[model samples]
Target: MNVPADDITGAPAELSVAEVRTAFQAWLHAKASELGEFRNLSTDVDEIFKSLSRLQRLLYSEGWIRLGWPEEVGGLGGPLVLRAVISEELAAAGYPPPFSFGTQEVLGPAVARFATPELAAEVLPRLLRGDETWCQGFSEPGAGSDLAALRLRAVDDGDTWRLSGEKIWTSWAQYADRCVILARTGSLESAHKGITAMLLDMDTPGIEVRPLRSMNGDDEFCSLYFEDVVVPKSRTLGEAGEGWAVAMFVLSCERGAAAWQRQAWMRWRLGSLAADASDLPPHTAGEALELIHILRLMSRRTVRSLSAGEQVGAVSSFDKLMMSTAEKFLFDTVLSAIPETLLLTDNESARDWRSDYFYSRASSIYGGAAEIQRNIIAERVLGMPKD
Candidate 1:
């Protein structure tokens, strides 16, 4: 609870994921008296986000969030899996991660790997501390599955690059401070090779964010418009034409490592259902439990692969596919077994179930669509010939 301040000049000791988890759990128990009670507060999405942000900042300030990051980036330095373990423990304990946690997993790695050391040192700490939020700018109206077809254009200027295009289904863009944007920097004929990645400030002139409502009754996704937005050369990620690699790296993290966190949350939801659903049909509970078990097994392998710095590559498609199947299956079970609670109850517990069930539909859509993951698994992982 009383983490020492960052040692600017001194080398910090590295801690393994297990050690960090044990320390964090011990700290959580020690601070249990001061920590706020976990509430289901599911109705107000903004309020829930605010509360989660505050929680992340608290953990960040105490140095827990910095454990797995590099000392140069304000972390104590350890295997990145340490952070993953922390997230799993938190979610298993019934604490929803701070809304920005996904950003750390999805975007943080790419930046840390490709960004200038100065940039990584300057920006990543802020992200860890919840002082800033970042969003991916990959999917476009026509580029959802065919990302190589994205039309966003970024032309190099002497001092800054000019960007113009639209990105759709960008989550939390309205609340994000920075975005890892992909744009066409070469000819349309170049396909993925011509694309480039850039880190742009959300407040840049000529940029707009329009929130889109989901079936869950929340504005969690947004459509972003970039009209000749100027981005500094320093904002570029990797080489001018290496955006595709950066994008692939980000997607791999999303599909592979991020799935671990989701599995942990799913397992927690399964336990909650078992505890609360008194009238649940036996078969329904059994099916949900089976799905959770499958997801946990698949995600555990993916997490270990990622933690070991393995390429994972097309193999991650299997993990993504299983995760989507498991998520939808578990939530469908919830809806069927607890229809009254999901549809009619107005309490926070019921609202959480309803909202989660609605959001579960997107599980197959985000990261990559279920169809796309299957296609990858068939063509790449299994080496099956494309039809």
Candidate 2:
């Protein structure tokens, strides 16, 4: 796990997605032996994260992971789709993405867009290099999917804000180096209008992280407590009382670009499921393929639109809804096909299947519940009435 520090000097300033993909494939082939250690990572979540960080370091050293970001933030300067291409290629090669991949797509863009230039330049490189990890601080007690209902309060304190509240269902908060949190800056009645987004170092005083173990037997989620945590005004993501825009933008990336990454990983998992199940039913496999392909198309459109600086708006709700549907169906089909692997066996592959099966049950809940997505599509996208 000893990765040498690398100066980002030789990376290309520009490259098409196709060019990036081709070169990346070639690199993977040439580095197959060196990358073999990542093929079978340890079951311990901490170990898995450590090994994945090494893989990320390798990719960053070679400039694959940094390809579409701004050079000012440690990138090679290409269309954002270039990074997507690299991620998909990694999955195709049976490699797991760096743990920071999701955060990079979800919170990284918001930081780059809404944060001050100095902040973006200072923090984004650490994210790109996997030198740091971040977690989103959106969901809270009684505000899981209804983000506007969150009650985390940010009180004015002259040059800083004092934060006090609890945030639930924060993914990997215990290991995070930073967090993008939303707090109420106005009256409770103001709801979304009074919200404001801010960036905070996870190690700040008066902050506590309590890990929550999921059914998958992993401490993947956490509950964060901020008791009079002081944050500088310079850390505000956007203007005070304008955090709704930041929240919306972050959620858009979560549902849009993050969906793209998830679908890629799911597609790879589908292939793994097929190879492991010797007697896998043809119809089930076909059905799974169709579901994954549909998600692929939807996610691809969203990724392209986002790369082009286009606002996908409520339509991304379809991608979010379909992603969960496809994921649940895919994993459910896995459990149904190989009940023994998931429920009876104790080997590594079996453990993987077992973990994924249990985790899939939550697909309908995280990143905005499936019901929330449906409601968004119905009321916002289709002009349906909420009665």
Best by lDDT: 2
Write the residue-wise lDDT of candidate 2 on 90-136 in tens digits: 88998887889999999999999999999999999999888899999
Write down the worst ten-residue block by lDDT for model 2.
Answer: 1-10
CA-lDDT, candidates in order: 0.83, 0.88
Candidate 2 TM-score to native: 0.96
Clashes of 1: 0
Checking candidate 2 for backbone clashes, the offending pairs are none
- Alpha carbon lDDT of residue 3, candidate 2? 18
lDDT of 2 at 196: 90
- Summarize candidate 1's per-residue lDDT along 12-38 as a digit string, tens digits: 244444556666677777676566554
Q: Stretches of candidate 1 above 4 Å error?
A: 1-16
